[model samples]
Target: MQWIECRVHTTHAAHELIAQLFITHGANGTVLEDSRGKDFTPEPWTDIIGKPKTEHLPTDGVVVKAYFPDDGTLEATLSAVKKDLVQLEVTTNQPVAQTEILLTTVHEEDWAEAWKAYYKPVQVSETMSIVPTWESYEKRREDEHVITMDPGMAFGTGTHETTLLCLQALEHIVNDGDTVIDVGTGSGILSIAAAKLGAKAVHAVDLDPLAVQVAKENSEANNVSERITIEQRDLLSESSNEQKADIVVANLLAHLVIALAPDIHRHLKVGGKLVVSGIIKQKEQEVIDVLKQENFQIDDVLEQKDWVAIRCRLTEVGGE
Candidate 1:
């Protein structure tokens, strides 16, 4: 399918708001690129040696991409993105002289095949290996572990930086017989990982109904269906449960993570760790600050590429 690359350039202050606005309005597969990073930092999050669950992913400037039909609607979307645009260009139809955007077409099969080239077996720490569903590996290859995952449009394929950071954090913190909950458990990777790690019980919650079904199937495929239960729960809302967990792991958007910080802390036992991810580097501090108000002690930070994952532990003091 051909894609019209609508380029919208804005300051770092407006990046998140504009990108989110466009995607919410109707833009699909929005890819954000950092044109001029003013509030950027130098050192990478996983630069420290001996950090667990650290993956050596490419270090690229802030860029988010989304896919959508090339139509006039892009103009409206771009306008909604920001009032100030140093450069605004759209690539559509036959290349016009006035348009600065690059017009490129991609066949659906070709794009899929291209991504397949990067699909390789990933050793998630020493105990777990994340293998693509379509790929094969010899199990008898001495202590090799495998978690087969095929990310079908739903995130958390164990390939992204945030997921790997979380998985690495899990390896360090998760203990046997601990009651664990994976908020936004996509493809049941985190939930299944917890089960495989010997957690006494696991609850995988997702707001999307389809994700619930997908997670259930994945859990069954990994033979952890009995241990991990997939349920629909909106963490943003207050809900009463007969049980709270010893650990809560949420790999969600940075804003949602901040908004749900209080509830996340409430649902955890004292000193329980909350592993949070799916945050871009630019927004990591915002999430950390919000959690701090709820008496969460910032424990560890993991960064891969431009993404970040944080581990926060509930302190004896409840909240501010």
Candidate 2:
């Protein structure tokens, strides 16, 4: 099988939108490349650290690459994707600076394994590490947790700041025997991490069938299939009594998070934690406002590389 790889260069603000456009137009998966390194400075830490130093990484643009099967419809799909992206810029009135699109053909086998060259083990938190299936990583500590994943055509490998922020929040909140619901559990990384952290049951849900399949395979690879259940479902839309959870973590777009705030709050047990990520710094307050309206109280906030993750809890009232 052959695949057409489409790479789009655009501003960081437009990266997520562009990726969504590709997925909507039939791309299986997307990869983001931003030369800017992540800098996480919790609000409380700023006083102690005297303001963390920021790196002078590239700020010009980011590159987003996606793959589509080289079927006869490839051209049409790419054209549609481009059109959607252009419309997005027009709708937002913000230019996708340095916009460029490049296409290349790659064999299935080659494309499948090409990412491995750059997908080495990544330590997202103090005790959690993401290890690609093809890589060898030695644990440096006794209590470290390793999540083995291939990602394949799924959406996460724990390298993105959004994912890292969620993982960091999960590390502090997930307790033994607690039930966890991972909305949009791409690559099943969060589900696996929760299981490793002693969650008795982890339900991972995604709307994409390919993501569900890859997440299931990753859970099995990490020996957490028994604890983590991967399913194809929208965000808590069909949640029932059986789906109520102690911790609900969602690493999704800011707009989606805001839209699902009420549903997310409804699915959580009273006083349960809600960890949300994939929000840009500019949109952080918008999401927070929605969460507040949904009766959730902000507990903690994590920021990295202009992305923000928030940890909030369902309160009995507004104070509890």
Candidate 3:
């Protein structure tokens, strides 16, 4: 397969928004470039501090990808692209024609191999590790641990700062035998980890069916399939009053997290814990404000590479 790379340089705040917009209008996958945040290193972390999780990722810039079904006119896509740009320029390898969009041919091998050099195994916490299928972990002199994952069709592999922060937060808040609901569970990593860490019951939900299927496969791969339940439900539009959980973890975009604040509150048992992540640093206040209105008290806030995760506890009825 061949791909056409479309890159846009803009302010950090507009990075993901722009990429998402492209995908919404029919782009395959968007990549965001880290322009202002701390550069992510490839070193493994065996020991990590636990803190609150954030709802959206704070990014300075981003890159997005979109797949073209066939040779088509670039006018529509280009026009759609222009809607998100302010002081940016667009360039194409092929000349823009009237009828079809002819993207310059890019070999899939070229793009796939480039990411290989940047991929490596990472330990998100003392007990959890993130290992990509393409690489092998080096034998350490110490008794370091590892968590093997293929990444597959999901967006998270536990290598991103946001994911690492979430895992650390999970390590701190998830108690053995507690029920956990991981919203937007990608790759089933968080849900599987929770089960491995001793959560008695786990329900993982996502809006995407493929994500649900992928998470299920990952659970089975990690041998936690029987312990975790994967479901396809759009938390934003679905009614969740019938369900309640001891812990609810939603690692999602900031806007979506805010939208689900009331639902998240409704599904939590009294005094239950809430873990929120995938938040960009700048949007932390927006999410915190939304959750606070539902009577959730912030227990801790974790920050890593400009990403934040908030750990909150639901207060008792008629109590603070």
lDDT of 2: 0.80
Candidate 1 TM-score over all chains jointly = 0.68
Model 1 C-alpha lDDT per residue in residues 18-137, reported as the tens digit of each score: 455555656544444443333333233222122222121213333344454665576665555433232222322221122223334555456556545555666666566777677766
The sequence of per-residue lDDT tens digits that candidate 3 reaches over residues 1-320 is: 65565555444555556656666656644455454324444336453222212222235444334443334655577686665443222332222211222244556566555555554565677666666666656535353335567644224446666677778888877787888888877677889888877788898887666678878887887787888988888763463425688888888778988888876766889899998887899899988998888788999999876789999989876546
Q: What CA RMSD would candidate 3 show? A: 7.2
Please give the lDDT score for candidate 1: 0.66
Q: Give the Cα RMSD of candidate 1.
A: 7.7
| lDDT (C-alpha) at residue 86 in model 2 | 75
TM-score of 3: 0.76
TM-score of each: 0.68, 0.89, 0.76
Model 3: how far residue 5 lies from native, Å: 4.3
Stretches of model 1 off by over 4 angstroms after superposition:
1-115, 139-144, 236-241, 318-320
Q: Write the per-residue lDDT of candidate 2 for residues 13-71, one digit (tens) a residue.
A: 88888888888887888887665643333333111112212242345567788888777
By lDDT, the candidates rank as: 2, 3, 1
Please give the CA lDDT of all the candidate structures.
0.66, 0.80, 0.67
For all candidates, what are the clash counts?
A: 12, 0, 34
Off by over 4 Å in 3: 1-5, 35-62, 66-78, 84-114, 137-145, 153-156, 236-241
